[model samples]
Target: MSATRVLTLNVWGRGSAWRRRLPLIRDGLVRIAPDLVGLQEVWRKRSGCQAERIADGLGYHVTYGAASSRRGCATQGNALLTREPVARYDVLPLPVPDGVEPRSVLRAEVGATTVLVTHLTWEWEHASVRHQQVRFLADLTHLAERRGGRDVVLLADLNAAPDTDEIRWLTGRMADAWVSAGSGPGHTYTPANGFARKAREPARRIDFVLSAGPRAVHAELAFTTPVRARRRTAWPSDHFGVVCDLTSDPGAP
Candidate 1:
């Protein structure tokens, strides 16, 4: 089948930066014009909703699955955006220990693919929690395949490094876009944390695009978005965006 272009990003729905970064984020998406997007940390305040505004303005279809709302975003959660109309969608709440922020996965179907968007727990020290989450995801993916489904593509901010067990669990079941077709470190996180820009910490490629299916094969890492601003020196969010192109076997699932 023809290739599909997908983008995934964590929009950093917290703090005062949201207002400042909207323009840059909008422009970034417009430039990429991806066929589909799996966004984490999408916000919805009384003034406006991040996904709605972007979708309505750019003519992309959107579906949101909320997990919490400090909600700076009344419906703070994961969002799946597609240039084409979604044939179906599902939102599943993920398991998380009490006190940790709730997590959820937003799944959608467009054309011959099943796309899942999610944001997992962020504690680097809490590998156990991440592992449990990955197991659940693996099981869910298997269930879909058994039930007869198209290629499944998982896009998320996993918060786990490539070499980490949590990521290994996922990569073992699905192909990592970066590993299959990418160069450089593929770092996605960039936290300032009130420190000088470069002094805070180095970036990490916690974000990922993974796939598994009889037809899921030959993935090309299109590029990663910078999210930098023309008006402001700061980035749209603390995370970089990933874009990947995938060619599926037309005769297979």
Candidate 2:
């Protein structure tokens, strides 16, 4: 492939009318047709994993990392979906503060490409924790690239804005897709979405696609529109998804 399309989204776990939201997510994925997908806040149980369900019949292989459990049944975590069969996969537990929700990064190799998916600590006061997590991710990405002999694509709902120290540190080593190619503000978490209003977070771009080698050719926010239902408005997730196209030829543009 001359270019790879990568997408990242925080699926909001099993929260906020999950049953109704699943189809919307599946439909969005179909429309986007990304080669690689990174998802956070994915909930899974014996019935079936959320990522698997969404990827069903889509010809994508899924790898999930369980960060923590929800209630007594479902496991919550991050996931990576690839168009190619996975060559190898691993999960890294991120550093978390006491009494806080657990977080993890999932890595998968497809042919010569490596993809890493993660969800960082979300609280506004948890920047220090996110910093620790980013340091770990940075090192992991470097190691992966060295071993793979190719660029690594990182997808995440980082829960931190672009200017935050955690993101700044990562961007120093990688390229931010939105900054390179997105046309607008690219706010993934905003009160503009009725579902996101419950989070009380200021409008900001927290989702991302970063690459170690490829240059971003195009990018935009997705899953921002709501679907009309008889009883209520349905959105794909609490956060908007991000889609970016990347190319290895730096001189193409």
Candidate 3:
């Protein structure tokens, strides 16, 4: 079979900065022409929906899950876009600490592979939450196996660096795409907040694309100028996009 190109990005919110970054987002998508695209922190306000807009504009099918509880009528969460029709989709609620905001995993089936889109919490003190997230992903893998799925690709802004235990836990059963391809550590989270800018450190390699099966190949980061511009826009989010290519083996299970 042919290889599948996938792109995963975190579009902070539909803020003014996001508008500025949209052109770069559009251009990158046009250039890569990925088969699937996973998005985090997607906003769907009553007046407008960024996920739907992107899907419609790009001519891809879209599926999304709300991370937060319906407080009257606000919805925000993760989204998955695919050139192929989605066979099925669901949302997996994740553990969140008392003071932390809600988060969730959005799963969708594109052909034989299952793609999971997620955005981890920023509460560093709550290590337990991260552990729970890892367990949740493991459970999802098992669920896919039971459904006769051959592969699982998890992509997201994990909010944790590669050296952290949280990342290790999530990647325990999966191979990191970039690492497998021998690519250099591509830092994603740029300096956005005052503290981050003041430090003036290089970006952190927190965003990731991981695969549970061996079919993943040629996985690498997709850095764009829009991502840099968004980082400098004084926004709360400061993450770059991750892109990878997966080729299914003829004998894949």
Candidate 4:
């Protein structure tokens, strides 16, 4: 029973509101005590690092990639935190349509498993960008095979739902972790304002945990933490965190 608990969270960038949510995020991480943590929309200061802060607080090593860069300043794209030593790290930039924000995939090797984290574009009108992103992810399965990696898990805010074409494309080659574990239609993103009276209605299942070469033994929508919308605060991000428990190969260490 070689298995590890993994948690994915999209911490919207550093700003006034996001700063205030740090305690809530830290508390959530403390509660889960996951073996690995995948974070999206993280930012590193010109003189400091955001992932390092989280790693220090949680007692884990961190690896990340940049999605936006200007001169020497870079905005962190996706990050992976692991209790196990990181064997290697790489970043793959995904195609973004014009007028759309940048996106990238961050990959790290933990023990015998390789984890990839990403933040996909949110533009509904840019079908080409979605197509390219899905294609790139599907290609990762092949990449893993060539590298002799037996398992790959991708966690991210895809900005598309289960029924969407992009998701179908990606799932054609990889297993959806939630579906594999029998977690029913978990909604990751909730309206930032009041759930009902909010001007914008939540319509999509943007966040996900997709796995290959292994089965998800347990999965659930992470709503137990105070980060989940309370009466006082809407939420840390417009998206909710997703937790997946993966059962690795019995032979894997």
Best by TM-score: 2
TM-score of each model, in listed order:
0.86, 0.96, 0.86, 0.88
lDDT of 3 by residue, 52-116 (tens): 87666787888888898455677889998888789998898888767788899998887778888
- Model 3 / residue 79 / CA error / Å: 0.4
For lDDT, the strongest prediction is: 2
Task: Please give the CA lDDT of all the candidate structures.
Answer: 0.76, 0.89, 0.75, 0.76
Which model is ahead, 2 or 4, in terms of lDDT?
2
Candidate 4 positional error at 149, Å? 3.8
In candidate 1, list every pair of residues with a backbone clash.
188-204
Superior candidate under TM-score, 1 versus 4? 4
Candidate 1, residue 251: lDDT: 59
Once fitted onto the true fold, the runs of candidate 2 whose alpha carbons sit more than 4 angstroms away are none
Per-residue CA lDDT of candidate 4, range 1-253, in tens? Answer: 8567888878876744665577666777788888888889888867766777766757888887888865577676888888977999899889876767778999887777778899888767776688798898878767885788658888888888888888888888888878877455677765532321253756446778888877787778664334344445545455677887888665542
Model 1, range 7-48, lDDT digits (tens) per residue?
A: 888877764466666776688778877788888888777887
Q: Quote the positional error of residue 121 for candidate 2 in Å.
A: 0.8
By TM-score, how accurate is candidate 2? 0.96
Per-residue lDDT for 146 in model 2?
77
Candidate 3 lDDT = 0.75
